[model samples]
Target chain A: MTRPNLQVALDHSDLPSAIKDVTNVGDIVDIIEVGTILILQAGDQAVKCIRAMYPDKKIVADTKCADAGGTVAENVQKAGADWTTVICCATIPTMKAAAEKIEEVQVELYGDWTYEQAQLWLDAGISQVIYHQSRDALFAGETWGEKDLTKVQKLIDMGFRVSVTGGLDVETLKLFKGMPVYTFITGRGITAAENPAQAATDFLAEIKRIWGE
Target chain B: MTRPNLQVALDHSDLPSAIKDVTNVGDIVDIIEVGTILILQAGDQAVKCIRAMYPDKKIVADTKCADAGGTVAENVQKAGADWTTVICCATIPTMKAAAEKIEEVQVELYGDWTYEQAQLWLDAGISQVIYHQSRDALFAGETWGEKDLTKVQKLIDMGFRVSVTGGLDVETLKLFKGMPVYTFITGRGITAAENPAQAATDFLAEIKRIWGE
Candidate 1:
């Protein structure tokens, strides 16, 4: 069984706070996502600074590019992003342009998509899929509902790498213990904690306990 | 008989060039969109700098937000964006959160939609609709087809503040001249020219000639 990777989503609007959390918990994080707000707030420097600090972990730029595919992809890749996200809502051609630009830099593409657009993205050769449970749903005390899980299952069944995000916590993660989730992207659950390192360590330990390393 | 506003889409990856383009063409341009690449490369500081430099024109942060509505909206608004864009592909509640956040800051929402999602966006009260032409389609030498124009007509009939973009130039602006396009977003046609001011002037002149503004 493939153990799910643990990705830390750094979404701080400023650089110092984001760096502090990464410094605290970098060891346990298998991947780091420079979240949409951070990218919008700090620019490519957010990813570059994080990459310079933690070159070992994969850095994902959550630019959520809806247009200007070549420029957006190259900017993020040149800033040292190993992977970048292209929103599925952008046209198939736009998505393709983004994917091609990332390819030029030898970086991977993570298609942030809804279920209806799954087959189309898959057909376009998008490798990884991010199934985002809306933050509103998470804040409203929603669980990882059965329908969302079913989509995850379908994506996994379709032979795609899948990551799940949206206020993920250790308790909710345990529900998919044996599933092949490529990554569990947690932001507030880890970075917002009193001790970020300990929170990340706990999350990693829980993953290992269930998936047996 | 409302005249379509001329918008300079600043998509430079850095500040100086973007500022230069605006300085050259700011007179004819009614709105200035800090494009996605500029936002990703320079942060909200991009918008703030442009707003400070060109205070008269409307400033838009083309964030194309894929998630985390509150933070993205707040970040752009704080940076002085008069409007911000949200991708229609994000979940409905997520889109609403973005819309509400922008409204809270007294800024407007530019909902970037694919045709299929138009009615849903309108029903959800997304005020402005951007009919983006994929950059890829333009590169493929594709003209704006009837299908695309039909949606524009439909949205205009439905009373949406519709903006048409995708490599719009002086020639194409004539096609939609008599139509009530709320805005025409032009990037390279003006910004990439040897004389950006002249290019923009020509575009504005064409618009005025056709619409008799």
Candidate 2:
């Protein structure tokens, strides 16, 4: 199995703070996610600025698009995002439109979604999926457990490059000890840490320790 | 008994085009929507710029938020949007977070939503709901018909200040002749017209003809 990539989600509500977090840890991270909140606050400039700063880094614009898939995907592509996200709730047509416009589109698992939907997304030419534990769900004390793992495993088995996100920390890394997670996305796990660079290094170390370098 | 508001959707891919459309019909329209595509391309700067130009206009940032509701809502609010949208697929917790942070939150009806969900939105303190016929759906030949009207009527009966959108034209306005629509959101119907100002005027005139002044 290939080693999992480490993606840092820059979910800060401001561009300067997000940029600061990236400046501290950008070198260590494999992918930079200009998070939804940051995008909403700062606009596509968040993606443009980050893309300008890290020319070779894989940038994910976490737009969480629900409709106008082609337009949204095309816009982010123009802004320099390598990949963008669409909510699972969006229709197959939306997915098809997005997939047609961008390099790659990830289906963000949110609210009620099904494995059947994942199949359709693949059929629509999207191979990336992000299994998310939402912030509110996390705030309500939900944690990653067997059920989430089961779904992730199922998605992987179905040929998705499955990524995991939402309030992830180093300790949480141990949960997926032997699983072939495509990427482990961390936001506050690193950005909110006292030392973001050290936090990123620790996350990378954890990924290597669990999945083997 | 109130006349429905005429809200122009600035769904252009860039700020300049959207601004030009707004400039053409801004004074006559009751709401200026910084559309999802524009927001995706330009970011909150779209809202901020529109707000700067039309300081007194009620700007709607069509964020179509799927999660991190409070952050998205608050960010748009700070950017001078009077309203922001949350997708129906978002959890009640998400809607509550948005409603708590903003003056008002509108649930943008997309795929697989129910009156039960609308009640939950109301319970979460959201009163506005935008019934969307997605662009993809329109492309697939989905038209506004009886089923959609029934749902819109049901939502109105349930006490939501319902707004309708999706490929709205002058003739489509006649369909909601007797309904109490809170707003009629038009995009290309006006913006893409040869005379955007004339199209906006025609919409206003049609609203008066159907719903009465």
Candidate 3:
């Protein structure tokens, strides 16, 4: 199994703050996410600026686009995003429209999804799936848990590059052991830390230790 | 029954173009929507610019916020939006956060929602529920049809203000014959017309004719 890559989610409201935080940890992170909040707050300028600043890093614009797929896809691609996300709940026609628009960029579908819905997205030719742990469940004393692992493994078996996110931390990362996850995304755990770079390094080290990278 | 108010959805990518279009029909439109595309393209600047240009107009920022509702609500409200939209698919925690942050602004929710979901939003203190008509459905030769009316009335009886949209035109306005729709939103029909002001006036005229306002 391939070792999971680290994606640091930038959920800040301003570009300068995001740049400052991410720049400090850019080397350790394999992917940089313009989180849904950051995208809505700063718009395409945030994506363009980040792309300009770090030409080598893989950037995903988490538009969480549920409709008007063609327009959203076209706009984000023009702004220099390498990947854009669409929700699993979006109509197949909308998803298909988005896919057609971003033939040059990677399209990821969120797997905070039902088994039936996941099958629908994969059938629609979406290349990736994002397994989101519910924030409510996390706050209600749930760990990554066995059910999540089973679901992740099921998705991986279905030929999708799976991404795991939601309340991920050093402790929770262990729960993903033996899963064929393409990437592990963490937002507040790293970006909200006093020393973002060190936090990123720690996350990277944990992933390496777990996966023997 | 309250006569449906005509709303013009300005979904352009640039603020200047949007302002020019809205200025032409500002006198006729009852509500002006800073559409999701515009909000994503220009950020809060789009909302602020429109508010500055037309102080009396009721502006709805179609942020379609799926998460981080507090940040979106606060930012859009500060930008002078009278209302902001959140996706119904967003977590309940996100909805609660948005409601808490809304001081005097209305929160609108959209998606393939049921009456139960509308009830949940109302209980969460959301002000309005939007029943979006999908463009792809229209493209696939489906009219607004009968199902929408039943859904609209069901939501209205539940004390929720229902906004109906999806390529609405002069003929489509007739479909809501006896429906208690609070708002009738038209985008390309008005904004993309040869004479936007006249098109908007005609749309409102048709609504008045149908609703006997």
Candidate 4:
């Protein structure tokens, strides 16, 4: 099986801090996510500025569109994002609209969703889905468990390039030891670390350790 | 019943055109929406710029938060938006997070939602909701019909300040003649018109004609 990729979710509320994290660890990570908070606070220019700095790296504009998917997709594509996201609850037409505009569109799994919905997304030509443990859920004291693993496994089995996110840390990497995760997305776990560079490196090292060279 | 507020939705892809529409009709319209498209393309500054231009006008940042509600609400609130939107599909916790941060939060009604769900949002302390005839659904030949009116009426009965939107035009306002809509949101109906100022005046005239001066 191919190794999973390490993606740093740059969820900084400001541009300079996001840029600092990217400057510190952009080379070691497989993808740089200009996260939703950054885009909301700093604007689409966050994607443009990061794109300018890392011409060759994959960048995600986590716009998490719920509607006007086509317009949102086109906007991020122009800003140079390689991938963008739509909420899983967005309409099938919304998903189709987004998939038509961008090279890759991931359905961000939030709240409650069904495999039936994932099938429709795949049918609509979207192949990537992010299984999230949302911030509020984390704040409410939820944790990654067998139930999440079962859903992720089911999606992978159903032909999705599944990426997992939400407060993931290096220790959490050990949970999916044998699984073929497409990508592992970490935000504060890496960006808010005392040494972001080392944090990023540690995440990559753990991935390599678990999934092998 | 009180007259419904006329809100102009600036769903333009760029800032200049959005600014132009605001400049032309900012005085006539009751609210200015920094539409999801504008926020995605131009960033949250769209809210700040409009707030600066018309300090007295109510500004709605249509952020449509699916998660990270607190962060998204805080971002738009700081950018000078008087209100922000979270999708109807968002979790109750997500809705609560957003409501806690902003003075006013409107749940943007999208695909397949229930009064049961609306109750959850209302219970979470969000009193405003935008009932949308989504653009994709419109492109697929959907229209504002009895079912939509019924749902809007029910939400109003349940204590929500119901705001209706999507592809709304001057003539369409005639349909809700006697309905106690808290607000009527129009986008292309005004902003994309040959004369936005005249269009705005026409909308106000229609609102007055329907619900009286």
* Candidates' chain A TM-scores: 0.91, 0.98, 0.91, 0.98
TM-score of 3: 0.92
Q: For model 3, report DockQ.
A: 0.43
Off by over 4 Å in 4: none
Best by TM-score: 4
Retained native contacts per candidate, as fractions? 0.58, 0.68, 0.27, 0.65
Better of 1 and 2 by DockQ: 2
Each model's lDDT comes to 0.78, 0.89, 0.78, 0.89
> Over the stretch B22-89, how does candidate 1's per-residue lDDT look in tens digits?
88888778988898889899987898998898776788888877567767887898888878887766
Indicate the fraction of true inter-chain contacts that candidate 4 also forms: 0.65
> lDDT tens string, model 4, B1-213?
799999999999889989987899999999999998888777877988999999988999998898888989988998899999987778888888988888899998766677888888878788999988889888888998998898888999999999999889988998887789999999989978899899999999989988988
| A1-213 per-residue lDDT for model 1 (tens digits) | 868999999889988889988998887789899988888899988989999998877888988776667778888988998888877556666677877767421112222345556667777788687777767656556667887788788888987788888768888887786689888899999999989899999999898888878
- The CAPRI-style docking tier of model 3 reads acceptable
Pick by DockQ: which candidate is best?
Answer: 2
Query: Interface RMSD (Å), each candidate?
Result: 3.7, 1.3, 3.0, 1.4
Reference-based TM-score, model 4: 0.97
TM-score of chain A of 1: 0.91
DockQ of model 4 vs. true complex: 0.70
C-alpha lDDT of residue B68 in model 2: 84
What TM-score, computed on C-alpha atoms, does each candidate reach? 0.93, 0.96, 0.92, 0.97
DockQ of 2: 0.71
Estimate, for each residue in B43-127, the C-alpha lDDT of model 2 and write its tens digit. Answer: 7889999999899989999998888888889889998999899888888778888877788889888777777878888877788
